[model samples]
Target chain A: MNPNVPDDSAAASRYAIEAVAEITHVSRRLIVVYCQHGLISPVATPEESGWLFDEEAIHRLRHIEHLRTEYGMNMAGVRMMLEMLGELEQLREEVRFRRGG
Target chain B: MPAAFKDYYTTLGLSKSATEVEIKKSFRKLARKYHPDVAKDKKTAEEKFKEINEANEVLSDPVKRKKYDELGANWQDGGGYRPPPGGRAGAGHRADGTPAQEFHFEGTGFSDFFEQFFGGAGRRNYGFPSGEQEFTADGGAGRARRGADIEGDILVTLEEAMLGTMRPISMQTADPRSGKAETHSFTVRIPAGATDGRRIRVPGKGAEGTGGGVAGDLYLRVRLAAHPDFRPRGADLYYDLDLAPWEAVLGEQVIVPGLSGAIKVRIPPGTASGQQLRVRAQGLPIGKSGDRGDLYVVSNIQIPTEMTDAERELWEKLKVASSFDPRSDSKT
Candidate 1:
C-alpha cells in the first residue's frame, strides 16, 4: 500500500487485481509485476488466496501507464529507472547527513 | 478473411519462444519509434502504432500467445481465416449479402492493408476461452455489448491554461461487483493552446463494455479559474494598460506581464484611452505551428485625485497654453 493514499474506512471500498485490471487497462501480469517489482503495493493484505488492491493501486497504475504510453518505457525499464532515482535520493540524503546541513 | 497466422513472434521482432526480456525490449523500441509526438506524420505513425499495439496485445499475454502458437501449422498458410460457407462483400454482412450487422471504427482511420488482410473473419469470431460462451448464439441477439462512455473534468489556473501544464486529476470510479467508489488519479497532458472551453478525449479510459464490445472513452473538459490580473479570449489575453496622464500623452515603453514572463509594451505617442496596441505572436498558442495570437494593450489614462502644489501649477500652465477645449461645442 502506498503511504500517500489515505485509508478508506468503507467496507465495500476495496477491490482485487482482477477488478482493478478492468478499470485500468493494465493486465493482471503487469499488475503483479508492479507489486513484485515494488512499483506499487496493495493497501490491504489478503486473507486466503489472492491479494487485495485498493483505489491507491489504481492511481499508481495510471502513473506507471504514463511512463509506458507517453514516455514509451516498458514495465521493467520503468522499474529500473524508479529504483535508480530512489537510490540517487538516498545518496543525496547521506551526503546531507555527513555535512550536517 | 482467411485464418492467416499473425506471427506474434515476428511482430515483436522475436523468435517463436523468445525470453520475457527480449519481448519487452522489442516493444519498448517500437513504442518509442511510433510514439505520436516523435512521429509527426500521422497516417504512417497511426498505422504502425496500431500494429504494435495489436502485436503487444497477443504477445504480452502468455496464454493467448501459447494458444496461438499451438494452432501452428493450421495458421501458417492462412488456415483459420475461413469464411462460414459464403463470403460477405461488405463488413458484418451475411453470406446472403443481407447486411447482418454494421461495424464501426468511428471515423478513426485504420490501415487499409491491415483491414484487407486481418479485418474479416479473424476479428469476427475470436472465440477466446474467457468470454466465448457468452456470445454462442447461432446467429441472432447474442451480440456483445459495448461499454458506456465516461465523462470527467480538470480544473486549472489561468496561468496554467495560458502556458499549459500537465495536471494529475483524481476520480472516483465504482467497483463492478462491490459497487464501491475507488479513487484513481491520472495525469493529463494539457496542450499549450487549451482554453476553458476546450475538451480532450482520452480513448479507452471510460466505462468498461458490458459484454464483449469496445470500451467507451473519457472526456476531460478543461475549466480555467480566474486570475487576479489577466483574462483570456480565445488565444489572446486582456489586461488594463494603466498609464499616468503624461505617460499616456507622451507614450512610454511600460513593462507588463505575459504568459511566459514580463514584456515591454510600447505605447505610441498621442495614444488615447481605449486605443489597442497589438504585439504579434505573444498571446496563446495557435495550433501546431507553435505561433500565437497578438497581445492587445488597451490604454487607460489615470487622473490625479490628489496633487502636489508643483503638479497643480504645471497643470494650470498647461491648461492656459493648450488650445484643446473641454465642452467646446457643447450646449451644457
Candidate 2:
C-alpha cells in the first residue's frame, strides 16, 4: 500500500494485476502491455512475483481506455495526449494559483 | 419527454448553405476554442464543447444533414414540428419490432437531444459499446457487454482535501426500458491529497448493464471550492502575512491559519513586502507517502493610513532620519 494514502481500510486495499484487470475491464494482456509501455508503474510483489496496483492505477487505466476506445487513438497517440493533458492541467493549476483561487 | 428542436447550423454559427469544407473549418475552430481541456473556464467550456460537438456530429454528416434539412423552418418552430412516424430518425428499431436496445450517454457527454435523434446511428457508426449484450428472447448465449461509465463533478473544500472525507452523491438517470428517471445515491470516499481535476472512480455505480452484464463505474472529477483565506498551489497553500513596518524590520513570530489549525510562522528580520516565507511540511498532504508540501506566507507590509499628530511627527522624524531611496536605481 502507498504510505501516503490514509490508513483507512477502504483506501488501503491493493489489487494484483488480475484483480485490476477484472475491475477495470482491461484484459490481462493489455494490462501487461500498459506496464511494459511504461504507461503505468505498478508496485512489484515480493521477489518480483507479480504487480500490485492501487486505486490510482485503476483510474489511469480507465482514462487510457476512454482515450483509446472513444477517440480511436493508438497507444502512442494516447500517451501523447495524456502528456499534453497533464501539462495542460499543471498550467491550469498554476493559473488558478496566480489568480488566488 | 418532449423532444426539443435544435438548429444545428445556428449552433455552429454556420448557414444551411455552408459547404462541407466550411463546416469542418468552423467545427475545428470552435472546438479548439471551447474544448474543456484547453479552455480557461472549464465548466462553461465543457458545456460549449458538448453543444459544438453535437451540432458538428449532425452537420458534418451528409445523411444527417439531408434529414435535418428536411425539417427546414419547422426545426426552429419549437413544438411546431413533430417528426413523422417511421421517419429515418426512428430507424434504429430492429426489423422484429422490439424497441431498439437502449444506450445511455452518462459519460459520453452527449445530451438527450443528441441521443433522441442521432444516438443509435452514431453508436452503430461509431461502434461505441452499448453497455449491454443483446440476446434472443429464449435466453440464448450472447456477448457480454460492459456498462456505460458515468462522470460528474464533486466540490470539496480545502480542509476536506487536507484530510480524506466521505461525500454523499446522488444522480438521476432515465431507465432505458421505461424512460422513467431513476435516482441513485451513494457515498464516495475522497482520499487525502485530492486536487482539482483529480478523478475518483466508484466501481459498479454507473448505468446498469443489460442482459446480466456488470454495471459500469462512476467517475467524480474533483473541483476545489474557493478559499477565502488561502490559495492552493499543487500541494502548497499560500496565505497573506500582514506585518507592521516595525515587525518587518524586526523579525516577529506570528500565528496564521493553516490547513489544520493555527501555526506560528517566523517573519525574518528586514523582510520586504511581497517576500515569501516558507513553512516546511505545513502544506496539504501529498499522495499516501506521509510527506507534505510546504506552505508559503507572502508578506504584505501595511502602513497606517490615518495617524495621530504624535505618530505623524514620529513618522516625519523617521523619514528625515532615514536616507533610503527606493527609486534611486530607476532610469526614469
Candidate 3:
C-alpha cells in the first residue's frame, strides 16, 4: 500500500483534522503524532482522506491537555507517561477483552 | 435603630482596639482571596466580596465606624430604628422639642444609621444646623472625593488575548445626576499581552457621585480561558509540537501551531521528544512598549503503530542496521 494514499474507512467517519483542531486547540500534526505514538489510537478506519475522531480521542486529548497545562509535561514526558497509563488501561481491558464485553 | 453591626471588628477578627493599619492589611489579604472575581464559588464569593467591601467602607473611615460602634447591637436584628425628629426628618417626637434619640427597631444597616446621623457630608434637606456644622468641618467641605472604583470580570482565550480584543461589557449604575438606575453598555479595549490581575480602567463607568460629584472609574480584572495546546507563564508562551519518528531522526521543516495561526519551524536532526526551541517575540507583548515575550516550542516524536509488508521489510532491515538502544538502563 502506498503510504501517501488515503485510507477508505475514514469515509464512513465524520471528524477531520480541522474539526478536532477547532475543538481541542491542538494542531492536526500533534493529533496525528499522538496516534502514531500510541498515546491515542484512531478508532475509525482510514477509508477516506481524513480520519474520524471519537469521544474517547477527545477525552485522551483532554487528559493530555491537563498534563501539559497543569502538570507542565512536555510531549516526550507525555509519551513516557502514557506508557505507564497504557499499562493500567491494558490491565483493565484484559478483563473486558476476556469477557468480550 | 436597635443596634449597629460590628463589621470592622468582624473583618479583622479583632476588637475595636485593632489599629487602622491592621484592619487595612487584613482587608487587602482577604480581598485578594475572596474578591468574587478570584474566588472559585461564584455565589458565595460574591457575597463575601460585598461583605468585605462593606466592612472596609466602615473601617476605613473613622467617623462612620465610630457612629457605627456607638449604636448597640439592637439595631441589627430588627428593633431600634426611630427616625429623627421633625415632620420631614422622620424623627419621632413625643410632644417634646428636644430630639428623641433612642432607637427602637432592627434590620437597618449600621452604615445607613451612621450616614443618617452624621448626614454624610451633604444633604441640605434637614433643618439641623449642628449636623451641617459638624459635616462641613470634618474634611467634608470642598472635598472632591473620587467615586468608588468598581470591579468586573472578563474571560477570554489566549488567541483573543494575543491579537487584542474589544468586548462589550454590561453594567448597571444608579446615576446620581439623574437619580435613576441606568444600564450602560460599552466596549472595553483589551491591550495586547495583558496579564491576569492587570486592571483596565474605563473613565466615567463607575458609580456616580452625590451632590454633583464626578463619576467613578470602572476597573476590569482579566481572566484567561484554558487552552488545549498553548501554556503561558508570565510573558512567555509554550507549546508542544509533534513530529513523526522520521522527522525527529532527520531534520525537517515542521508546522508549529500558535495562538493566532501556524508557522514553519526547522527541527534539527536527531531531535528528541521534549527538546524545546524558542521563537522570540512571539508570545505576549510588553505593555505600551510594543515588545513581546518569547514562544518556546517543545518537540514530540510520534512512532507509527502498524507497518505493511514492504514497510515491515524496511523496518526489519533498519532494525538490524542501527544499534541504538532506546532504553540503556534496562536490566533485561
Q: Which regions of candidate 2 deviate over 4 angstroms?
A: A1-13, A43-50, B1-142, B287-290, B303-316, B327-332
What candidate 1 gets wrong by more than 4 Å, as runs, is A1-101, B1-144, B158-164, B175-178, B326-332
Q: Who wins the lDDT comparison? A: 2
User: Could you say which candidate leads in TM-score?
Assistant: 2
Worst 10 residues of 2 chain B by lDDT: B123-132
Model 3 compared with the native: what TM-score? 0.39
At residue B221, candidate 3 shows an lDDT of 47
Candidate 1 residue lDDT tens string, B1-332? 22235565776788876875676668767766775445789678746655664565456556556645644533335335433344433233333444322222211222222233333112221111122222335421446544433333444445555566555445445543345555545555666677654545554545445546665545554544333244566677666688898888887989987767788888888889878888787787764457887787778787889999999999999999998876788945
lDDT of each: 0.56, 0.68, 0.56
TM-score of chain B of each: 0.52, 0.56, 0.48
Residue-wise C-alpha lDDT for candidate 2, range B71-176, written one tens digit per residue: 6544545553455666544423444555444433333345556555654223231111422234355332454555656555555666677887876555556653
TM-score of chain A of 2: 0.75
Worst 10 residues of 3 chain B by lDDT: B122-131
Query: What would the TM-scores of all predictions be?
Result: 0.42, 0.62, 0.39
Colliding pairs, model 2: A3-B288, A4-B288, A4-B289, A5-B288
Q: Lowest summed lDDT over 10 consecutive residues: which window, candidate 3 chain A? A: A3-12
